[model samples]
Target: MASSAAPAPPAPAPPTPSASSTTLSSDGIPTLLTIPALGIKAPIVVTGTDPDGVPETPPFDRPDEVGWYGRTASPGSQGASVIWGHLDTPKQTAVFLYLRDLRPGAQIQVARDDDTEATFTVERVATYPDDSFPSDLVYNDPGYPALRLITCGGGFDRATHAYLSTVIVFARLTAIGSSANGSGTGPS
Candidate 1:
């Protein structure tokens, strides 16, 4: 008689985008973040939060998309623009998987709904475990227009069967330009 193998682990819960803590800019148009190197692009949406003041996970249907907190500072504003996406999914390719391979000075572009594009360059890359996640350092940097691209990485855990760390690509705005309705945000 053949023996049965152990069942696979349950999938990790989807990340919740913060609701109450998020801050939006004066303009209602959400910022669009694009990683040309990885061909990943998505609109940052506004979310509300819980009574305990914790951010909620983003919706599951659009795991490949990245969400920016409207409450946070914009790309060109005073604080770092936080952007989050998923790593590989159980069935399909997820955006930002190659974010770990991005080198310092790599280009990151953000296009506002108002037709303005801000170009940023990678400055550093870091990894953080889920349990000890650094909320303030990653999202509260008030330096030059900064950008952080986040996703899961590290070897898959056998016990947890999920990614061990969150890969964060830290970049700063280097240039800004404008575009017409359809031209798109390209380098000047």
Candidate 2:
């Protein structure tokens, strides 16, 4: 004889913030991201979060591009701005492969659609298991401008087909400058 019980319900999805939940700058669309120390320069695209609240990243075919969480605060806005990249693709190292190598005090410059640049100074680098992602620290509004650069790190798991850990680079807003129609200083 079998028990006559219904299957358990699935867990609720993570919260997805509204566009108005965070302050958005007039030129919030990030056009480019450059990390001088890593010699990385890539175009940026706005990506939405999945139903589980995990940010969507660029497709494997677009390995050279980075993706910003579209619903989150803008890079220079009053919250934790997030950007992610693939560490590697099937054939080559991807856009953020060296993100974990960034040291505190390194510079990250984001050029926006309006031709202005937001500069950030790296504060810390941390690696955590994928299951132990720190949601509050990574996504909450910090009451000031901040940036988080994330990429796959640690070892690869053949069994799960995923990386064992995620590398996060936390940075603080340092300065904003005019890029003069995308011709600003810094790498192209």
User: Highest TM-score, which number?
Assistant: 2
* Candidate 1 lDDT: 0.60
- Candidate 1 lDDT, 91-187, residue by residue in tens: 5556666788888877887777766676788888988776666766676654455677767776677665577677788887666665343233322
How do all models score by TM-score? 0.71, 0.81
lDDT value, candidate 2, whole model: 0.73
After TM-score superposition, what is the CA distance of residue 134 in candidate 1 from its true location, in Å?
Answer: 2.9
Clashing pairs in 2: none
Provide C-alpha RMSD values for all models, in order. 9.6, 8.8
lDDT of each: 0.60, 0.73
**Candidate 2 residues 1-188, lDDT tens each?**
00111111133233334344222363467889999999999999998756654457777788889988776667876667788898887667799988889999998988888667888889999998767777678877665678989888878876666787888999987777675643333222
